[model samples]
Target: MSTAVKNQLRVCLLSVQYNIMREMVNKVTFLTSVGFMVLNNAAILAQWFILLRLREDVGGYTMREIMLLWGLTAASFGLAHILFARAFSLPELIIGGKLDAYLVQPKNVLVSVITSSTSVSAIGDFLYGILLMGLCGLGLREWLLALLFTVTGTVIFTAFALLLGSVSFWFLRMDMLEGQVVMGMVSFATYPDGIFEGVSRYLLYFVVPVGMAVYDPVHVLVSFDAAMLLRVLGYAVLLTAVSAAAFYRGLRRYASGSLMGARV
Candidate 1:
């Protein structure tokens, strides 16, 4: 290849790296907010309840590693707001028929709505993530890779939210059911992926991907297994594609009445 071509590829990779760094900073901010909002005010032993007990029960884990893991857990939830902060409004828009206005707008409705609101709740997650990164014995390169895992995991989880929210167009009347299911998925992904057994584990990791969002990616972060990390990338790609396809399919079925469907 030409020297110019090599330099161009190098610059492109650097740009991508820069963007990832900026996003990690954003994730850090989101987790930080969550700490101030919820975790910080709670008793320190809440850490014991939410974090320490798991290490004791699981064995072969240290308090420091547990703290990093706990921070990851917090950051995971914080990053979820990246999708859910907007997902929360979809049912209301559908119910009120204001969704029609969005349909007529000159921009992508999802883009507009998602951009219009953000989950500040994610700030807590970001706070915890930075702390977790600081606890590492790993090099900065390793730390950056972990951030990539967390961010990719965050995107996959948002895809989960998008999948759930898109269901509104189908049942219209079933938004509550949709919301409950998404929230339930939230419960599933909040903890480490290792804790579950058998079919439930299969469901979260491959079938639905909630556990992959935190568990597999975090596992790769903790262990530095290239093969396992590659598997996560594959899962992320497949899940994102499936969710996007599902959302567009649901979009075709959307029926905005004269706000009449909701009144009945």
Candidate 2:
């Protein structure tokens, strides 16, 4: 690898470690938050279990496939928040002039800003996803595929959020709209892909890109198609490039908040 690439990776790893340590300072509180989050996800998953009992499948997704869907979604969401929690806060940072703190750092501004925070509760989600995968009886090969899917899914989720949040650079007070769009993507991702048809299916595949993030992964897990896996990887690369470009392009229009603050 190139020196610059290695350096950037090192910075990212250090930022993640620091944020995790900061969150863990209050160990009891962190544990409680994680526990509650896992329970909450379990409660939501219970509804699916109940629904599946009444019917054989929903939209051609058997209970096993649905389990994979939820597993991937939770794992991806968890990974995104754990690593790039601040991506979701980009709009507020831009509007409130919080970017000044990150911009002053020697590291990549977007990377520094996003990695500055971690969601402790997301630990539960990550754990819960693994539990669900086990419950669904994923073998070693399936587990490896799921892991790859989770990473790609994380990339898609973080990139989409950053892309939406970047709108704050051009418009005023767009945080709510961006937030809703992201929530919509997350909400839609947990359901069976077969449920949506025609225009809605297209929107899932392209507009929100949940198909690439979650559905396609689920399909690959079920059938193991190389072409589909390549498409998923391709979309992740494309979205990452687009979001990073948008962030840097918007940086030119960024007006520093000049707010005094210490990161450490």
For lDDT, the strongest prediction is 2
Which candidate's TM-score is highest? 2
lDDT of 2 by residue, 1-264 (tens): 598788988999888988888888999998999999989998887788788899889889988898899999999999999999999889999998888878777877888888878889988998888788879888899999999999999999999999999989999889999899999999999899888999999999999999999999999999999999999999999999999999999999999876787656
TM-score of 1: 0.71
Worst 10 residues of 2 by lDDT: 255-264
Tens-digit per-residue lDDT, 1-264, candidate 1: 587567655554453444345456777674566557555623442654665555564333355444555555556556656434565556666556656655775545564443334556565556666666566666787678767776776677667667667667666666777677766766665455556788988888766676566666666666778888778778778776876787668767766668643310
Clashing pairs in 2: none
Candidate 1 worst ten-residue window by lDDT: 57-66
Local distance difference test, each candidate: 0.61, 0.91
* TM-score of every prediction relative to native: 0.71, 0.96
Q: Cα RMSDs of all predictions?
A: 7.9, 1.2
